[model samples]
Target: MAEVRPAFDEAARTHPPLREASSARQDAHPRQIRDDDLAYGLERVLDGLAARLEA
Candidate 1:
């Protein structure tokens, strides 16, 4: 129960911070995200995830 409590509390605290960060980003100018940039970002994210999973 003690171990679980910390995990739950951490998640609760983290959620608000993430939401705030996202809100801040949303408040900024909406730039045109090019398809090439989207593809590059997705590839980088997937590659990082794959490397972590393989480790």
Candidate 2:
């Protein structure tokens, strides 16, 4: 793998701090998670399993 320092410095013009990186990721994927999404996903998985068993 390529050394990361050179590309990182070129991108940030200095060593980017942890706060900047964390904030970028958090902004891209907000933390306000919903239980409804999880439940819906689980329901789909269980439904698939039930269908397979019936087959």
* Deviation of model 2 at 41, angstroms: 0.1
lDDT of 2 by residue, 1-55 (tens): 1365456546765545844764454433233324545777999999999999999
lDDT of 1: 0.64
Model 1 TM-score is 0.40
Model 2 has a clash total of 0
lDDT of all predictions: 0.64, 0.60
Off by over 4 Å in 2: 1-33
Off by over 4 Å in 1: 1-33
> Which 10 successive residues of model 2 have the least lDDT summed?
25-34
TM-scores of the candidates in the order shown: 0.40, 0.40
